[model samples]
Target: MHNAINESYLGERYSEWSLDSDSTIETPNKNQAPWGLENISPIFRAYENSIWQNHVAAMWSHLEARYNITSNDSCGTHVHISLIEGYSLSALKRICQSIIYFEPAFEAILPRARLGNEYARSNWLDNPNFGYKRLSRRESMVVIEKCTSVRELVLLTPTTISSLGGISSISLKPLKEPLNFVVVQQARLSAMSLYKISKIPATVGGLKWFIEAAQLPQQPGLFDTRYINLLLDSVGPKLTREPKPMGKLSPDKLRKLQTKKDEDKRKNVMLAKISQPPYWG
Candidate 1:
């Protein structure tokens, strides 16, 4: 496959291929080539397995077309192509897997800044502190109390608090609307740890707030259950409610809930299916 690609794109400029173990090619001026061409190892064969080979081929074709360069010997001397040596197939596969995983996270987190929410927009501004500098501890708590919805609260979180060092306090109140419980917890933590170490607080409470909030779960898990557990372990013994049997939904209630969910899904599908295309006529 590599030979075929070389023949198609490299042709006469493709000099005699030298298979090597741990060799570095030097440019005429003795400086390393910008592409690190010297490092092209023989083990790259496993690295350039089918999918990666296809990607490289596509890239080559694109450059060829864009530059209007032919595979024929446009220049007289042979062009030296270097391949890196000594990587196992497993290593290459891991690299590809990492790219697959990272691409989605990047897509998810990158465009969040563009969301229309005022808090989201403000937090995304290109300031040295990433917008957390705008609020003090007291002001942050005030903002959290003022947030009426989960989305607003989530957006406000990163901006309001600095970090979660440890658990300070936990409280739960019954909610009447979309959710059954409103759990408010306070923690003392650092901004850097909240932003970089923990994913739950970063996503659920917001990175800045997570950093300053002293209370948090020692064990890693989803925010709802983890926070509840932390509260139960630290502050639960203080509460008076007798533990009730976990409530069970009646069949009729379950059916009604499922019906509503199906309707929501159908509406979303229809919305997504509708498309606007240019019509010259």
Candidate 2:
């Protein structure tokens, strides 16, 4: 699989350069991928639109031509938006808030199988049975609004534990707060430095523009799939519970948390000195 994928592209495979096997292509669930034949997933590095069309798209075409590639209801694509340039603290906050705010509308278009799938669960809906509180637009915004750093912003996303045994398999268990504390702690330890970036385009136009861009016509009522809300109990949290702050750190304390490299500099410097031969003096 790796050789076939490498033959289709020019750059080094990520596995060729990195020790993190998790970042490389992974095999899809046997239940989901096409049956009767072995499945091979060739993950590609992030690329701009043109490069995506020329390289990634071309690779898929090559695979389809060489092998009788097929898809089914169980199969789905995961599109990861790259953070190569990263985002401003405020922009990151808005994106998170926006996702939570517009999630229902986003779910409206998805196929029936994706509606409440455990693998990609809804972030806004709180299923008491599953144990979590749903956040309102204002409540969600307040949570995001309080974010003072990248680490705090990231913690707001769904937390997951890897499926047993390996990266090649696509299995994960979503963890809620308290249970997710260890993962949260590790994230803080590896937090990236918060640096200012270019201005983020205004998201004020909101979902209106999005629907228009999607060419979906404005309608009198919500998409007829309103049944999903009742069936999945995805309308909102039926039981009232307070929205928890994504992080406990006060503004002052958050400011004190340093990037991993900055936190380790003194030890690194000492190690560098110790590795050197002692002065002849």
Top TM-score model? 2
Model 1 lDDT per residue over 187-227, tens place: 22112221233343223223223323534333221123333
Best candidate, lDDT = 2
Off by over 4 Å in 1: 1-57, 65-133, 136-150, 153-281
RMSD (CA, Å), each prediction: 25.9, 16.9
- Quote the positional error of residue 182 for candidate 1 in Å: 34
| Worst window of 10 by summed lDDT in candidate 1 | 162-171
Report the lDDT of model 2 for residue 198.
Answer: 12
> Per-residue error at 195 for model 1, in Å?
8.8
lDDT string for model 2 (187-274, tens) is 2223322221112111322233332333322221222212222322332332222222222445643443343224334222223323
